[model samples]
Target: MTAIGIYGSAGRMGRAIATIVETEGADVAGGVDAGGDPTALAHDADVLVDFSTPAALESHLAAAVAARTPIVIGTTGLNATHHALIDRAAGSVAVLQTGNTSLGVTLLSILVREAAQRLGPEWDIEIVEMHHRHKVDAPSGTALLLGESAAQGRGTTLGEERVDSRAGLVGARTEGTIGFASLRGGSVVGDHMVVFAGEGERIELGHRGEDRTIFARGAVKAAMWLADKPAGRYGMTEVLGL
Candidate 1:
């Protein structure tokens, strides 16, 4: 049986992970919240799952490394520094990270990439995402991941051509630009849509997550999968064999 340690165990996603681990016949070694010690918790488990905030990422990664435990991270809102830290830690332990853990969302990203590649630069791409009102990030990490997939298919970098949104007095939409729009409202689990618009036709690829447990299940799956792999960095695409 897999031994699991959960970080941010008090939060919504954390609790969901804990529930899934318990129900799946896996061992819940221990957990750590904001007020607890992750290093101590990690020491008792084979793999650590993190659904915490960006502020806690560094410490969590450090704890996992010190304990020589694998980690599956589902937290979003990462910047260059976080990527750097993950890369550093991957040298010592297996690490899997994903912006969205739903299997459907991962498939949606692949479809978005295919559409971008087939439609060419003439068709503009836009990503729209929504989450619960309590979400702190403006554009959900899932939206950015979808945007990156589209940008990659077009052979360009996301940063070079991202249009977050348009406001009053905005001019015509820019060609070859990928736009992102975010919405937050009452208890929305998660929603993402990638729109491709051209002269005569439009195509939309989307995914809707009705429950947080989809993510929790995926994270646990990732933790179990990463436990046997050699030290390296991985994503949900690898986890799902996309």
Candidate 2:
């Protein structure tokens, strides 16, 4: 049986992954939360899954590399520096990082890219997402993930095409730009919809998270799939063979 370690074991996603591990026929070798010994946990497990804060990601990645163990990162609210760290770690150990780990969200991303690719720039693209009130990040990671997909379809990058904010006097929506709007409210697990507006018709692609288990299950599946892989960066698409 695969022995998995959980970082950020006290958080909701951490707890969820722990519960699903055994059901998937894997063993929870150990877990570490804030201020805990990550190096020890990494050394003891065959693979590691992180849903921890971005503040601690560097240390966790270092531990994974030192132990030569694979890690799956589902942590949200990350910035460019964190991605660079993941890229660096991937050189020494297998690393799979994603905005969201739910398989449904992964498929939705694929579809969003395809739609944007086929549609013309006249079809203004907009992305909207809603998560629980407790969530702190604006334009939730999943929202950005979808934006990246649409940008990819247009043969551009999200950094160049993404427009996360628009206020008064934001005169007119720019053509070919991908817009984002984030909503927060009570108990919403997650919801994302991408809209492509044209002259007479519009296309919408979306995904709703009714529960957290799907993400937990998907993270576990990624961890299992990554355990024996060679050092490199990966994503859920590779996990699902998409």
Candidate 3:
């Protein structure tokens, strides 16, 4: 059985992963919260799952590299610098990172990409997402992930033509650009929808996460799949064989 360690163990996502470790037929190697030692837990665990804050990413990834343990990162709000760090760490240990760990969202991304590819640039692309009231990120990572999919289909990148917000006097929507809108309220777990608007018809692909358990389950499934794999980066599509 795999031994899994939890970074930010006391947080909502960490605890959610903990609750399913046994159900995954894996042992909880240990857990570490803010200010705790991740290197120690990494040394003891066969696989590490980090749902910690962006501030803790460097240390957690370094720990995974030092211990040569596979790690699955579900933490959101990562920037380019964080991605560079993960890229470096992947040279030493297997790493899987995602905005959302729900399988449904993973598949939805594929559908969004395909839709965008089938539709022409005349079909404007827009992405919208909503999370729980306590969520702190604008344009939730999952939204960005879906936007990336649409951009991929359009032969461009999200950074090239992404629009997060607009106020009065914002000009006409740019062709081939991907727009994003974010909402936070209530206890909504997660909701994402990608729209491709054409002349007469519009195509929308979406996913709703009703509970955190789905993410936890996907993380566990990813952790187990990652264990004993070659050093590299991976995504949920690989875990789901999509």
Each model's lDDT comes to 0.89, 0.94, 0.92
Quote the positional error of residue 110 for candidate 1 in Å.
1.0
Supply candidate 2's per-residue lDDT for 44. Answer: 97
Find the candidate with the highest lDDT and give its number.
2
lDDT of 2 at 97: 95
Model 2 quality (TM-score): 0.98
Put the candidates in TM-score order, highest first. Answer: 2, 3, 1
Clashes by residue pair, model 1: none
**CA RMSD per model (angstroms):** 1.1, 0.7, 0.8
Tens-digit per-residue lDDT, 164-215, candidate 2: 8688888887899999999999999999999999999988899999999999
Instruction: List residue ranges in candidate 2 displaced over 4 A.
Output: none
Q: Give lDDT tens digits, candidate 1, residues 1-242.
A: 99999888889998898888977668788888887788888789989999889999999999999989999888999998998999999999999988988878888888888889888999989899999999998789899999999999999989988998789988998899999999999999999989999899998889989999998888888888898888999998888898
Off by over 4 Å in 3: none
Compared to the true structure, candidate 1 yields what TM-score? 0.97
Q: Is candidate 1 or candidate 3 better by lDDT?
A: 3
Please list the residue runs of candidate 1 whose C-alpha ends up more than 4 Å from where it truly belongs after superposition: none
TM per candidate:
0.97, 0.98, 0.98
